[model samples]
Target: MTDKIVESEAPLTLVGGGWADRALLADLRRHAPGIVAADGGAGLVLASGEMPLAVIGDMDSLDDAARARIDPARLHRIAEQESTDFDKALRSVAAPLILGAGFMGARRDHELANFNALVRHPHRRCVLVGMDELVTLAPPDLTIDLHPGTRVSLFPMRALHGWSEGLHWPIDGLDFAPDARVGTSNVATGPVRLRFAAPGMLLILPRDALDPLVRTLLATPGAWPAP
Candidate 1:
């Protein structure tokens, strides 16, 4: 088993080497004060004039200058080429919720991989913050209060079935699969409630919903067990 690099009771902010800005970082830190970096994400953390509690990655993208700035004890390198740095960092963290920035809005392929990592580690409740939206894996049962007409998109990583409330188009009998029917651009009629038969559904919401989503996930008792 991979040893945990960070164990936190409060939420953690995980920065990747993607398109993150100072405002995004500062906003995320407001909810999740503890910070960790994924590979070259150390550069972003340093640029923000703050140091991460730990940097977990393969060390390929992390530069020498950033390496020199960080304390040696905080750098935990895993010399394997199989997984992405996002995967490494996500798996190593034991937190109630992880707010990830700089993992989206850069490369499409990297953003896709980051989504893949979310489902891959269902036990880790993480929300990836983008410029305009936030994405997270739908827990076994989730309820969030959102305004009517809010956009709630659900993308499946694999085959699954689910039911919903407060969505304009319900997903009761729908068979969701990556290659089959996918839920996107769905509108909410009121407060939203979602229950998934499996652990592959990705919940996409507006960036403003991060706080309520985090609260819902933390309060919900139903979470996918580690596989």
Candidate 2:
């Protein structure tokens, strides 16, 4: 989507390091066509009974035996010690949507770094599928749908115009800033929908109930602003 070095996977599945997010893992397992392992994520893939299509990253976490177990052609063992393996994997593919698992269970610093990747790669249709919820960064005025009971959360990356509808308490006119603004955590009052008048916001939700959520979000249309 960004004209970068992304290989088309149409429906790609990215593997991260959060082992206990089974609900999210289950959802990704059901939906992803192929898997991309970030560093040591191959264990999750193997444990899940799915061989990875490609393993991209710095090769720090993988043992020689583990590396031997994976198909060599599928391994894109990037040795760039300067960046996180996650970032290396992100640059390697283009999928209409990339569903990732296991990215937030490590150190807080790693977790925050992964979070940064989500927003920075907004040019591609990607979603960081995780335990307890999902995350995606989008330009202002994006709409999202959630399963009737699915919980949703929104965090602003910056201060900008906020106009919302469908939340228990919708904001028609407001300015939200990352340092001092309150985000909206609400339920779907007849299918969640909202629009903003600026750029950049983080979206989160409770796991796979997003089938309907995605359906509702795309029921509108969109433009790509970043990657």
Candidate 3:
């Protein structure tokens, strides 16, 4: 990773290549003005009529046409296979919150990599937006006001322990392992509270919960645990 950090005064949006929808980009940009694309995502950002602050990735998926459109100074090529474009952009950008679009819904592997990126860099607070779900790395401690019956699924990227209240299935006293047991399809009985004993928990909630989650992430005050 480069020593230079791309800091944003406001929340940032990461446009990826799994799937690009013009309307989705516009909506996300409304909240996150600073936009950064992940390789091929530059093409989608251009198609949406918005210029990205920078396009960061390995540069393999970036076609000549897309490269020609992006300012040379804004095009950052990491050219490393050990990490994906999503990883490159997330680690490079510094923002209070990051909302990622076009990173989910197309390929399962690509989506999974994006999730891996989220877990790998716990310091980056990013949420991946899909058609129907919003995935984010669960903070060390989180509290959200939600209506009863709202879906609050927790998927562990690594084995960890945590406690929760106001959920149909309490996460308390549960041994969570990535490959062994996952907490999915849990329902929120009311306003929910979560205290993660460690990092590596992934929080999946309904798409409509995106805005509230973003606000919660910003209002909460604490630095992420070291990876």
The sequence of per-residue lDDT tens digits that candidate 2 reaches over residues 1-227 is 36433465455778876543445556765655666788788877777777877788877787777788887877777776766777778867876667777776557787777777766666655667655667776544555554465566778776766666677767667677788775767666656666666556777776666575555434446745653
Clash number by candidate, in order: 0, 7, 0
lDDT of each: 0.94, 0.68, 0.89
Candidate 1, superposed: residue stretches over 4 Å from native? none
**CA shift at 174, candidate 2, in angstroms?**
1.5
Residues 63-135, candidate 3, lDDT per residue (tens digit)? 8988998789998889889988899999899889999998999988988888999989998889899888899
Candidate 1's residue-wise lDDT over 1-227, tens digit each? Answer: 74899999999999999999889999999989999999999999999999999999999999999999999999999999888899999999999999999999999998999899999899889999999999999999999999999999999999999999999999999999999999999999999999998899999999999888888888988689997
Candidate 3 yields a Cα-based lDDT of 0.89
On the 0 to 100 scale, the lDDT of residue 15 in model 3 is 93
List candidate 3 stretches off by more than 4 Å: none
Better of 2 and 3 by lDDT: 3
Residue 214 miss distance in model 3 (angstroms): 0.6
* Structural similarity to truth (TM-score) of each candidate: 0.98, 0.84, 0.96
Model 1 RMSD, rounded to 1 decimal: 1.1
Ranking by lDDT: 1, 3, 2
RMSD of each: 1.1, 2.9, 1.5
